[model samples]
Each structure stands twice: as C-alpha cells, then as structure tokens.
Target: MSGLPDRTDVLVIGGGVIGTSAACRLAEAGVGTVLLESGALGSGTSGTTAGVVRTYFPGNPLISSLAVRSLAAYQEFAERTGTDLGLERIGLLVLFTDEQQVQDFRDTRAAQQAAGVDVELVTAAEAARINPLVDERTVLAAAWAPEAYACDPPAIVRGYAAAARQAGAVLRTETPVTGIDPDGLVHTPAGSIRADTVVCAAGPWAGTVAAMAGVHLPVTTYPVEMLLADAAGSAPRDALPMTMHPSSLRIRSWGDRILVGMGRPGPDETRDAWLQRVSHHLGTTFPALAGQGLEHGWSGNLDVSPDGMAFIGRDPSRPFVYAAGFSGQGICQAPAAGEIVHDLVLGKESWIDTAGLSTARCPGVPAGTA
Candidate 1:
C-alpha cells in the first residue's frame, strides 16, 4: 500500500462493504479508482452487522428494491467475484403479536409479491413450522420470505475488496482520509490525492467525512448490540431461519449457536442493563432457552437518517457523490448502493429510481441539495 497515487478518476473514502462495492463497480467500468480505509476492511460496522438479508421493508419501496437486487448479487457472488461470502439461503420469519401489525404486513405483502419477492402472510401454525423457536401462542401472524438469507459480513467486505482490486482499483488499508476539498482534492496521512470524482461511504462516520468537504449530512449514529448464546439443548431439529419478533429482538441459528440482536438501548441504559433486557426478551419469547448462558456480546453503530432511508446521489455543490445513512440496512442494500454510486459518478441514469434517496429528501436540507 505504498506510493500514494497523485490522481485518479475516482476516490472512494471508506473500506466497508459499501465503499468496496462502489470501488468494485467503478473499476469494473474502466474508471481509475482509489479507495482509502482508515482501518482494516470491514473492521467497522460492516464487520458487526447481523447480516440478515431480506426484502421486507414494509412501506419502503426503495429499500425493498435495493434489498432484492442485493440479494440476487449476493447469490451470484461466487460466480462473479470468485469469492465465497458464506451465504446461507435460510429463510426469514417475522412474527407479529398485534392485529394491526398483521394487517399492515398483509397489505404490504401484496406489493412485495408484485415486486417479485416471494413473501406471504402465514398463520401462527405455519410460522412455527418454518421456525420452531417462536411461541405460536403469542403470535397472531407472520410474514415469510423463503428467499431470505444470512451471510458473513466480513467475508462480504473481503469479497468486494478482492473484486475491486482485481478490476484495477487501488485499495489502501489504514490510509485514513484527513481532509477533502470541494474541488476534488483528498488529503490523506500518506499524501494528497486528486480525482475527478469522489464518493464518501464511510458508514457511521460518513457525516464526519462529508463535513470535511464543507457539506452537511444529517446522519445520526446509534449503537446496536448483539449476543451469541449456545442453543444446544433447545436448538431446532432443522436449521433455524432468521426469526424476528415485533419487540425488535432478532434471533437466528448459527450452527449450535443462536445469534440474538436487540434494538438500540436508551441513552440512559448501561451495557449490562441492555444485555439483561435482551436476555429477558429471549427467555420470554422462547421459554425453552431460559437461563441460557451467552457466549459473546458486541456492539456496532448504525448511520441513520431522519426518514430511515439512505442518501445515494451527487452532492449539489461539492465535486463528490455520497452513499450513506443506510440505517442498519447497509449489508442487505450495499450492492445496489454501489451501483447507484457508479451511475451517479458516471452521469448515467440508474436502473432504479433514486429520487427518494437523495440528500435533499432529508428534513432541513434545501431542495436539490444532492
């Protein structure tokens, strides 16, 4: 990672899944691309993602489309990049206890089905059959997507980085971007890089990176916690699917271990209190797993937008494009985000409608801001 390039066609800041994927797409299109990462690839939020891949966004069409497209790319990842992402096509089961939630899901199911997503509303019995971990008595209905998957997040970052390298993108790990000028000069610890276009995909730190260029991105960072516990005694007979309850507790089987994720803890909550809350929900939802000892716990940040959507468009005043504010859906939506970045950088029309994902859509930002 020596001899910092003085100039390139594109400079991508961040080495997470989104940045690497954008670099891969740009380089594949014959653009001279340079990617800079402050730390090791995927060492950020991408490394700690729950890696649940599903196309059920309820009312968001943009996210649903991006997720579906990303899922397809992930399925063909090995064929295109010759890299294994550890993709497991274990279905997704979303359990709901409220009648209104069930009706909302039923309404959204039609649109999802029309969009080619294999999703359906099922009864409690049907949901239990798909994932026996759920307490059928407490569930009113569930949404089932047979094409959902759980993947290895770090492997995905590595796979995309390798593809970008092979496609002629210069990738430098540990090369932190220090400053950026509106005229396309990117300052780094090694040296400065000048490029015709730049992209900021720094995950949770994207707002900080964008501010370096004098642009304001309304991205908020929040922490998400997850735990892994041994489910040897109560493990389902068949491999369990990624299961979720309305309480924002997500559980999925990883061999003999169960990966459990809880919603963001309150600002006043301590780590121990958050873990206790997660454990309480886990035990209450599945009585069989009561008193299970957790093997590991970790936390990562999510860059969220006010509307809970991503910003994927060119900056109106800066000489750069940005892809951020994934709102915890980065892993499942990264491939599409990369493609959108490539299209915006090249001044080409994206295959999907990206009007709603622009930074201008954010509240308080002027219209046409991005």
Candidate 2:
C-alpha cells in the first residue's frame, strides 16, 4: 500500500510531451499545475517519436495550419527559453512510384500551396540531387515541403518540464497517477494531490487514466516502431528531408544516423506486438537497410480518438481537463495546444477554436473532454 493524501489547483496525468507542455503553459501563466508520469519524462510516444515535422497531409486540413504555426512556435520557444531541444528544419520529401500516386502527390502539393505552404514539386532527378541516396528508378516524382523538420522529442519534453518547474509547476516522474476523484483529488502511487482541474495527456494509455475518473473515451491504442540506423560517421552533407515511402515507411536522417520508422500500425495489434510487426515490416520494405544493421529500436503507443483530433478542453460535467489523441500528430501541434489548454483551464478566451477537441466533441468520453 502506498501513501496517498490531500489536494493542488491542477493535476496532470501522463507526463509525456502534451502533459509537460500543458504544465509549462499553465505554470507560466500563473496557474498552479502538477504533472505525474508512470515512468520517466517523455518515456511514452513523445520519447521515441521519429520527430518528423510535416505540413503535408491528405486528410486533415488543420494539420497544415497547425504544422506551420507550431514550427514558428518551436523556433520562438527555443529562442525564448534558450532550449535547444534538437529541433531542426530539414524539410520533407514524399516520393511517388506510380503515375496515379504522382498525380495524388500533385493534388496534395497543390492543396498545400493553396494553403500557403512553401512547397515545390521536383523531378525524381531533382530529388536525388537533394539526397543522393534516393534512386531515380524507384522514385518517379516527389513532393518537397522545405518547411518540414524534426526534433529530439524526449529532450524537448525535458526542457518543457524544467521550465515548468522553474515557473512553479510541480512535476513528478516515477509517480503514476492512480485516479482522479470526482471531488477534485488526484490519487497517485506516492500520494493524493488536490486540484480543481485535472488534465489527462496519457497518450496511448489516456483511456486508462480517464477510466480512473469514470470517463470512457472512445480511443484505441496503436503503436509504431522505429529503428535507429548506425551513424554514417560524418555528418550528413545533404540535408535529408523527412522521407515518406509509398509503402508506409518513413526514413529520416537524424544528423549522424537515420531513423527508420515503420509508421503507425492499426488498432488491432497490442501495445507490445506493434513493435515486432513494424520491425519485420521495415526490414522487408527497405532492401538498402538489410545489412547496414539496426543500431536501436523502440515503440511508442498512440491514442486514436474517435474523431482523430485531440481532446483539449475542460469537463462540461466534471471538474477536469485533457489534451489527448493527436493520433501520432502531437509534436507539430504542441505549441498552440499548450497555450489553448492553459487558457481553457482558466476559462479564458483562446484564438484557437477547441470545439473539435472538446471531450463533449465525442459522447461518452471523459467529462473532461468538455
């Protein structure tokens, strides 16, 4: 049995990037905030992310807007806090193999350009010129978004946590939140923290934490596995854009080595099994990666909300809040998300309309989704 005690102004669950970020924003805005993680900071989806920053998406239009806004926010955050969290603007390279896909790429490119995205359509040869590793035969055409980038996710969360603490927010790692009492107490393995507002940013396990508060979020878990390639010894001369292969594989160069992500798997697979499936899939997809050897690999579970957008607002029926279910698209949106969540908690007006992210956006979700 662990000791649990009394209450704070706000308690946050799943101390990953989103939670840490909410804490940082709230604290900086003079709101009392405390964050509790089951393990270490950034130990979940935020830690092992490919850190691929992209402004190109076929479906979600909010993605393009958020990507651009978040990119600017990341740069400004780094300069403001002096947090060089390894954020890099390496651009994005989306290759096509067939005529149909090329047309599709063009359609997407046109959509991006219309949305004020700085992008270019390049020939396969031009793509090869940008990155010599890209073969002309395999790549028929490519969509290039020069504004896309990458970052070291775990380090970014750490930086946010540090800044949050310095601003008077309480961050407790290795301190798993057990539940959220209806009466405003955050029960944890270490103790109980009292708060008027509770935020759940548990990523894949977000539903689990919401259930602790008698909330049923229609979110399923899907994990993606990523492999780290052996360093090429010298720094990569060609700025490797985030490359998305037609086969659902994403290869990203991280300075010395490359991050080969098998991409997000479906919801049927268990949290642990997704990695194995992705690893096997990645090895089969990339013949070039066969003998070079895998330096390291990891899996991060993602929570897919019913609507595929995040739940980032206060509880309509209960006294709590949340920012979950980015569907693996959280990093690029974190900057604006943090600001929105802080304002929502304080009932302050926010420019970013969070109507689509309310817990009420989907019925039966946590009252906090309101």
Best by TM-score: 1
How many clashing residue pairs are found in candidate 2? 6
Clashes of each: 0, 6
The TM-score values for the models, in the order shown, are 0.96, 0.84
| Number of the top lDDT candidate | 1
lDDT of 2 at 242: 81
What is the C-alpha lDDT profile of model 1 across 168-260, one tens digit per residue? Answer: 999998888899876788998899999898898998899898888777778888888778888857567667888888888888887778888
In candidate 1 the C-alpha lDDT for residue 170 amounts to 96
- The TM-score obtained by model 2 is 0.84
After superposition, the stretches of candidate 2 with alpha carbons farther than 4 Å from their true spots are 1-6, 99-116, 230-239, 264-291, 294-296, 306-308, 359-370
lDDT of 2 by residue, 69-91 (tens): 77777788889989987867788
